[model samples]
Target: MFIKNKRVTLLSYWTSRYLLTLMIGLLIISFISALWIRHTTLENRLEMIEFMAEEMVNRITDVSIPGIPPDERVPNFAEDRFRIRDMNPSMYIINTDGEVISSNLPLEQREQSTFSELINEKEEIRKFTSAKNNKDYYAVKKKIEIDDELVGWVLMVESKDKLTMVKQEYGQLAILIVGLALLGWWAIYFLSRRLAHPIKQVAEAAKQVQSGNYEINLSDHIKEKEVYELVSSFKQMAGRLEQLEKTRTELLAGVTHELKTPVTSISGLLQAVNDGIVTGQEAEEFIRMALVETSKMKTMVGDLLAFNSFAVDAVPVKISQLDIDNFMKDFLAQWYAIQEQTDIVIKIHLLHKEVMISVDLIRLQQIMTNLLTNAEQAISGTGEITISLSEKEQYVSVIVKDSGSGIPPEEQELIFERFFRGENKKYGIRGLGLGLPLSKMMAQSIKGNLHLVESTEKGTSFEVLLRKEG
Candidate 1:
C-alpha cells in the first residue's frame, strides 16, 4: 500500500494560521469590551435617572402649602419643568398610602395599576419587568419633605432597553475590529508570499538540477540580503557543477584511451616476441620495450589509486621536523640527477638563516617533484627553473618559478580542479590530469597549501606555504 503525505504550502499555511489567531484574539477583546461598555452605559443611565428624580422631588416640595393635608397638596408645576438635561424619565408624586396622586405617565398606563405594583418603598432604586408590556424598566425614588417631615415620594422611571443603546455601537465596534484584522492579514499574506517566493524558486531549481539540467534562471532583484545570498550561491553552485560534469565526461574518455594505449603496446610487443618473429637480442629488446610500457601503466595506476585513497582520507603521513635549506638541497640534487634534459638549468635561493618546519617528507617530495616535473616539461630546451624560499610571520613560503611559456590565461583558475587539464597539456600530456589536484591535497594533508601566485606569458610561479616551527 502506498500512502501519500499531506503537504501545506507556505502561503496558505502562514495566512490561514494568522487569520485564525487574529480573529480569535479580536473576538475575545471585542466581547470583553462590549460587556464593559454595556455595564457602564447602564450605570450612567441609572445615575441620570436618580439625578432627575432628586430634582423633581425639590420642585414638588417647593410648591407644597405648609398647612395643607398631604392628599390635598397637589403641587402644581409645568410638566416640562421636571425634565432635567437630556433625561425625560416619567415623574410621579405618590402619598405614603401608595396611591398615585400626580404623574407624567400616559393616561392609558395610569388607568392600569402596574405603577403601584412596581414601586418598592424599602429601596431608593429598583428594576422591574412589566407583565403588561413585557419590558424591563428602572424606577429611581426620592422622598419629598415639607419642613423636614416626609410627606410623599417622587419617582423617576426609565426603560432599561433605552439605556442599553450601546448594542448599536457594539455592532460598529465589531465591524471595526474585523476590518483591522483583515488589514493585518492582508499585510501578512504579502509578506509570507514575498519570503516564500525566493525559497520556492530555489526548490524548483534544485529539482531541475536533480534531473541533470544545470541551466536555471532565478530573479536577481531580491532586496533581502539573506534571500539574495541564497539565490546567488545556488547559481554559482550550478555553474560549477555544470563545469565539473563536462570535465568528468572528458576525463572518462581520456582515462580509457590512456589505459588502452599502454595495454595495446605491451600486448603487441609481447606477441611479436612470442611468435618467434625476432630472435635472441632483438627479442630481448622487445621484452624490454614491453617492460617499459608495463612500468608506465603501473605508474599511472599507482597515481590513480593514491589519489583515490587520499580523497577518502585513507592515506596517512609521517610528520617530522626538517631543516628547510638542507631538505631543498638534497631534494633538488636528486631531482636533477633523474632529468633526461640537461639543457634545463635549475637554481635555488634559500634564506640566509636555517628555517626548521614540521612537514611530511614523502608528501612534500611528491608536491615538489610534480611542480619541478611540470616546470621542466614546460621549458622547450633551455630555460631556468628557480626554487626560492622565504620566511614571513610564522610561515615559510617556497616559490617555484619557471622561464617557460606560462599557462594560458583562461585555464589558470582551474589548475587545481580534479581531472582538469590545461588546453596545451590536454593534448601533449600522456597521463591522467591529477598532478596539481593531488599535489594540493597532499600539501593540505601536511598542513600546507600549494597555489599559483601568478601565471603570465613571461613565466608562471607556484607557491607552497608551510607553518614554521614554534
Candidate 2:
C-alpha cells in the first residue's frame, strides 16, 4: 500500500509497472506476429516465383514461328506473348545476357528493374515480404535454368490474404488492448474504494472505542463478503467494550459509596468536639473515636489503592524458601488477641507439618489478614474460623472457613469488587468495602485464584491456590 517510488502514477489508478508491462507485452507480441505472417507470405511467393519462372522459360524455348521477319511484327498471339511487359504488372524477365527482350513498363535508362536486379545479384533466388505503399506484398526472384545454363531470371510477386488481415489486425489489437487496460484502471479504482471504505469505517469505530463510546452502529450497505465480516467483527468488539465500561462505572459508584461513610462519620464527630458539646474526658473520648474512624478511613483508602494498582513500576515478586507453617503461625499471632475477645473457636488445619514455599512475606500477610478479617466480621458471637492447607500433585491450596451467616449467592460473586458490602450486617464497622478486592488482587498477582468453595445459611468457605514447591 505504501509507495516507495513516486514516478509511477500517471493515471489515478495506473502505475508505471502496469503500464510498462502492457506496452512491452503488446509491442513484442505484435511485432513477432507481424514477422511470422510476413514470413509465411514470402514462402507462398517463393512457390509463385518458381511456377512463373518455369512457365516463362518454357514459353521462350517452345515458341515456333515459320519464317517470321526479324524487322516485321509477328502474328497476334505470338506478338502479344513476346511482349513480356504487357502480361503481368508484377512480373519481369531477362535474357541470358541480362538484357530485357520485352517489358511491361518502359525503362528510359539501361539500369535493370528491381525484380531483375534482385535475381541478378543473388543468382540463386531471394524471397521477401514488403509492407511498402500501405500494402503487404510477397515478392520472390530467381534465375531461370535450362540444360544447366542460365538464360534469364523471372521474379513473381503477390499479396497474401492472412498476412494482410493479420497486419490490419495488429492495429485493431492495439486499440482493443489499450481500451481494456483503461478498463482495468477503472476496475482497480472502483474496487479499491469499495474495499478501503469499510476499513476506514472500522478505523473510526476503533477510535470511538478509545474515546469511551462503546455503543457503535454498523451500516449494512456493504455487500462484499470480506468487508461484511470486518464490520461484523468491529460490532462484536464494540459490544464487549460496552459491557466492560458498564462494569467499570459500577465499580466507580461502589468506591464512592465506600469512601463517603467514614469521611461523614469523622466530620460529624470532629464537628461535635469543636463545638464544645463534649469537654474534658468526653472530648478526649470523642477525639479518640474520630481518630479511630480516621485510621479506618486511611486503611480503606490504602486497600482501595492496593487492589486496583496496575502499571509498569509495580514491585517485582521477591521469592524466598521458608516454612509456610511457621510463616503463618508467626503472622497469625497478631490476630491471636482477637480470638480471645469472641467466643468463636479458632483452629489451623495443616495437611503437612511443614511445607516450604517461596513468596513475598509482606504481600502474603496482607492476603491472610484480609481473609481472616472478613471471616471475623461475618461471625456474630459464637462460631468458628478455620485456616487449613493441602497440597495436590501440582499445586498447594489454602482454605478459610467461618461459622456465621453465609454470603448470599447473589452477593457472593460481587463481594471481591471494590466497595462491595454484605446486604445484612449488624456490625461495629462495615468498612469502606475494600478488603476482599485487595485480597483478590493480591492473590491474582501471585498467580493464584481465590474462590468460594461453598456458602450455606450457617457458614461460608474460601479456597486459595498456589503453585507447589518442587
Best by TM-score: 1
- lDDT, candidates in the order shown: 0.83, 0.66
- Candidate 2 regions exceeding 4 Å error are 1-167, 203-215, 220-226, 241-250, 270-292, 304-309, 312-316, 319-470
How far residue 166's Cα lies from its native spot in candidate 1, in Å, is 2.7
Residue pairs whose backbone atoms clash in candidate 1: none
What lDDT tens digits, residue by residue, belong to model 1 across residues 1-470?
86688698999999999999998899898989888888898898788778777776765666645522343343333345544443456667776655677776554565235556545457888888877788998888887778888777777677887776775678888889989898989999999999999999999999999899999999999999999999999999999888888888988888888889999999999999989998799999999999998998998898899999999999988989999999998998898777775787889999867889989999999999999989977888789999999986877999999998999986787888877777777778778888899999999998889999998887899999987876
| TM-score of candidate 2 on Cα atoms, chains taken together | 0.54
lDDT of 2 by residue, 1-470 (tens): 88786543223434445556766776787678667766665465455445665665565545564221121221232344433321232455566555554444445532343544455564444444453445455555555555667666555454444323444555676677678778765666666666766777788889989998876677978899888988998897788567556756765665576578778988888999999988999989988998988887788777656655632326566666667778768877877855556777779977657777656677778788888878887898878999888886566788999998898886776676555566664135656567766676667776666788999988989888766555
